[model samples]
Target: MKKRLVAVAFAASVASSFACAQTPVMFSSINLNAPHDNVVHGVRLAVLHGKVSEVKGVDFSLIGMSESDRTTGANFSIAFGANKINKEMTGVSLGWFNWNTGKATGANLGLANITHDVNGLNWSAVNYSTGTTVADVGLVSLSNKSTVQVGIFNKTKHIDAVQVGLVNCADNGFFKCFPIVNFPK
Candidate 1:
């Protein structure tokens, strides 16, 4: 009996230590006491809102989702209140406005889309990328290095592909600016 009790206690202690090693799954509320770390490794549901430092898995928010550092999975916010990504975004962002302060590697569909560096499509009424390497489609598309753009008015500092719109401007191309179609050497 004594030996059996000691074995059980030792097993419990080892199990508890392993549990603490793994980051807990968080369910955030404005009223509950939950994990408030900068990093989350599992799923998170923020009812009516919350913020985090970094997320590695799925995250859902009612009003808004703000990542102070980086996000490597999907994030959705019902209302586009303040959806800001400071470092990097590698998934889909669906909102009224999607703002990526750092590198973006996914699609952004909204009324307005802005990013510092992008490698995917930006489909919106107004799309702006400081460093674009893929495509931007909008009423007004602007980028510093765009590969292709289809819009009403397209502007870029350099183009390695083509632009199809009413007014296309390739600042460093042969024509400097053109209408209908434009390309760069």
Candidate 2:
């Protein structure tokens, strides 16, 4: 019986050693509750802090001061935090200031939001996207090809859609600059 126990312990140690030797080791943080895994496949709560390489589930952070390579589920931050989803973002992200440096196919709600390629809704006080976006609703919205914009001031280069705001500017459209509403023909 004792021999069996010893053997099991030895095997466990050997396996752990091999796991640690891996290039990208994923494990919980030293502070028991916090986790710093290579990939988060479940809901994670960061009371003080936490981080992950990729998130496949919900991530709620309280003053979450960390970054993620990519996120498929929701990413929420209390104070002001950001992530660089270089690959893609397919879920909702809520924070005071949100920044998605990759392609986004979901929604972003915050005080300020920015993305490279936005294919979904962006609702904030100020929103900016380099690529075409489906919708932008904020106080000031700007995009290259925003399908719809509802804000105080809206600006876009190609508006194959509509803009409803105080001042709308479609750089290359029939109604290049209009008041209240603008559209391209």
Candidate 3:
């Protein structure tokens, strides 16, 4: 009788642990102008707009806005839409306006790309990074620390690599403002 009671208690404890797990996973979510689940493991489709807490796979928004707290895979906003990752993005972000508040570790391609920290590439008409960027290729690129800046206008407080643009300005470079290329002293 005591053995059976112990077995039941162990099973109950295991079951309660599974029940208390808060991270919900979904295979697919279709959001039509509304918010979906907090966590999605698979594809998330939004017809007009979508708001979520986290996404592991693809998050696509057609003709509207896509907002998420964290994204691991591709985040796309089609037809001149906007993609906003509030916390961190580990993969590519493609849209008209790609905005990442925390950190972006992959490629950000859009008309205007803004991020706090970028580790890979920022390709847009206007690329702006508040913290640092490995590379920024756009018509206008602005960052605190850019390793490589290739654009028409490149401005940064500190650059460790090179800036190749029509007009380049670096505060800590050999030249404060150069016409074609600028590098650190």
Candidate number of the best TM-score: 3
Off by over 4 Å in 3: 1-36
Q: Which stretches of candidate 2 lie over 4 Å from their true place?
A: 1-36, 46-51
Compared with the true structure, what per-residue lDDT tens digits does model 3 show for residues 5-69? Answer: 99999999978875675433332223532223477666776555677888888888777777889
Q: Please report, as a residue range, the 10-residue window in candidate 2 with the lowest summed lDDT.
A: 21-30
- So what's the TM-score on candidate 3? 0.80
lDDT for position 80 in model 3: 67
Q: In model 3, state the lDDT of residue 182.
A: 97
RMSD values for the candidates in order, in angstroms, are 4.9, 5.8, 7.0
Model 3, residue 110: C-alpha shift (Å): 1.0
Q: Compute the lDDT for candidate 3.
A: 0.85
Candidates sorted by TM-score, best first: 3, 1, 2
Better of 2 and 3 by lDDT: 3
lDDT of each: 0.76, 0.76, 0.85
The number of residue pairs in model 3 that clash at the backbone is 0
- At residue 28, what lDDT does model 2 achieve? 31
Positional deviation of residue 66's Cα in model 3 after best superposition, in angstroms: 0.6
TM-score of each: 0.77, 0.76, 0.80
lDDT comparing candidate 2 with the true structure: 0.76
Query: Model 1, stretches more than 4 Å misplaced?
Result: 1-33, 46-49
